[model samples]
Target: MRISATVAAVSGALVLSAFAVPAAQAAGSDAGSYRADVAKIREAAHAASGKAALSGSTVASPAADEPYALNVTFSNVKVHSGKPIVVGAAAHVSVPVTYTLTHGADVDITASDFLTGPYIYKGTYAQPTNMLFGEDAGTCTVTSATTASCKATIDIYPGDGDLSNVDAGAWKAGAEAIALNGQDPTSTTFDITKVGLADQGGFASPNVTRLSKLTVNAAPEPVKKGKTITVTGKLTRANWDANNYTGYSTQPVKLQFRKKNATTYTTIKTIKTTSTGALKTTVKATVDGYFRYSFAGTPTTAPINATGDYVDVK
Candidate 1:
């Protein structure tokens, strides 16, 4: 399908050429088109920001003395239906950039003179990394007597090493252009010199919940009234790195009980789990009731409650 856009220019209506990049190459799917490449970019971009570089340096833009001169602008920079980018959500990010290349008064040019797309980068200005939005990318159409409108999608992958491990906050966006010939890069240079952030909406790491386990038991099924009843249990949660569930040690949990026929369970005491996620506490039996352990969970795990253990009072 033909995907085109119209840019309202100061002079008049500027028609954009039909976007021709396939779904596998572009940053996100085209409007009304089903695609996953764009989704993959966002997932990698927000994944971890990877252990790339974290330098505080900058580079100078190319001199205007080059063969051609150009300027670029970006719009519709967002992730997943224009939602703010959340790390690890596995969604697509769309960043469409438009380039307007200005030729020298003495330099004669044709529509085919402009190259494919701009040089896109992610991360901070001091630590930016190169990004490949697609193959044979970018499209250009003459909009005025001496200017042309060229657009391309800058797809981003949050989880990919290029993005997976950066700090959880605002990041910078960059675009540059040079002259491209049969085998050489573009000579006309244009760059975004200000704070151009792809995620102007906001950036965050999404909360992840892992599996949690809780257990409870009471010794001496039949105990006389006034006799002490011991309740014990262990709490554990999934360990991502370890790839297994292990004891969640030194955490607080609640010891709760409910009398027979009672509709609500009351918290009797607060207890901490040992290094092995073990809990132990005792209470005097006054009537037949049930005992259980409850965990409130952590940022990485979900809350859980142990099945009630019943004890009979004589």
Candidate 2:
């Protein structure tokens, strides 16, 4: 059972390394959750144009069974990647490279093979492939194109991974010496320190793998009990490829509502997922319970539950 670990696999090539990391450590179990760590290196850090810092946590080799976090700063980074494309109704870019393609970053020496999937976080880790895609950071060496610099075009809002809780027990980052590159290399260091969950709504966490941020926005108003309130929302990050795999986007989302101050919300409506992956539905807001919602659909991606949840109001 070779897990497809590194890079993209040619059309029908056998993918063995894909599940390497998860398989080796847990051998059929998901790895312990990790958080982004950055406090240790924050002491001597200074704001310089060439300075950048990254901090995050990883599963301790079964030897520890605890979350391990580390922080490191990089200088003179050369950013590499194809290009960033906006996903759905968000102001972020989604890296559209598959596992077979090679994307290079100056901070990391080994040109990263396209990512495989997020297997360890959900259930038991698979063995075979022995690879962990879309997580961890790397450092690289540059040949000094004279203007050699370190660049990280974070298309997946706050880098790919999961929806990290801001100010919670989730991952956090801080960057100084900020520079912005238009449709290209950004020349500044930005920090995601002390950010609140509300601010990171449209961003993903450094802990999880996949950067799918879907926000269901609704007006903040009190609803009357036993009334039919008009419910409307806009899905944030929706991406669908109907041609690649069989039924990649199938199960639809059921939109329901609860009372503003009641309990036990029930399904009052349903909305089907579109080819674009974003769905805007108008449902009936039943009862006066807390406005809660969720998606009854599931995805073919990795990291346990590919099925989306209620991103917002009831």
Candidate 3:
């Protein structure tokens, strides 16, 4: 299996690249070569930002001084079906990616040594603050002699240092391809002239948000009509650094209600979370219904609705 690599900078920018190294080469002596090359580029990018350097292992072997640019372009790229990617604290999240590839007819994307896939990045492509990619190369179907439609997946693991809290926001989509052209990647004298590389950035923008959760509880399951009912709940969101969920404080949350037999819920009141993300409010018991807490969500956090808690009125 091809293992994914993540390049994380001290500025907390994480980069994931889906450079296609064959399964065999990925496990060999030079396994670190491709990653090292990316790390070096990341270091330069960070230095340009006047920020701390990126953290990564040294390159096991030197890479080509330069790679020949290939004739290729990526277009009509869409990520996560045009929806935000909401990732939780622990479990890995796999996002689907689709795009159109137009390349020189001579480029054999299907070759075993050729690697290509779509990625999402923040900041300029040349000096991205963060990037995300997949563990596998994109699967393509030829639409014409020079054009193809492709699909791939980008996997995110919050616990694996693949993300930080600051990473939750808008990201731009891009694509990259590398053709080894039969060169021995493990060889110390690997020739750069035979390598072909292509990169296209700023195709589309997608949102990535931290997963959010909510809970609702109405006190006194059976209450007399016109009596007071205490409603309480909590709002929490993923904390990437802690690998867990924590309170989402000071955010507005709505209390909503629906008649037992109703199909839709009506907003009762809007309240903000406490310092610890706790929610509490009181409503009069008038009829039989269900209550829930709803969050509208921010750019950095996903929207969520708690399961309704039913209450009986006697």
TM-score for each model: 0.43, 0.28, 0.82
lDDT of each: 0.48, 0.26, 0.74
TM-score of 3: 0.82
lDDT tens digits by residue: candidate 1, 173-283 = 333332322222212332212111121111221232455789999867899999899999999875544445678899999999999999888999999999998999999
Regions more than 4 Å wrong, model 3: 1-64
lDDT of 3 by residue, 1-314 (tens): 12333332222332233333334434643334554333333333233234322334344433325456677778999998899899999888889999998889889877877666777876565456677667667788889888889998886767776788888888889876667788755568766556666667777766889999999999898999999999999999999988899999999999999999999999999999999999999999999999999999999999999999999999
| Ranking of candidates on TM-score, top first | 3, 1, 2
The most accurate candidate by lDDT is 3
Candidate 3 structure lDDT: 0.74
- In model 2, state the lDDT of residue 292: 34
Q: Which runs of model 2 end up more than 4 angstroms from their true locations? A: 1-130, 133-211, 219-228, 236-251, 261-263, 283-286, 296-299, 302-314
Summing lDDT over every window of 10 consecutive residues in candidate 2, give the lowest-scoring window.
Answer: 194-203
Best by TM-score: 3
TM-score of 1: 0.43
Top-down lDDT ranking: 3, 1, 2
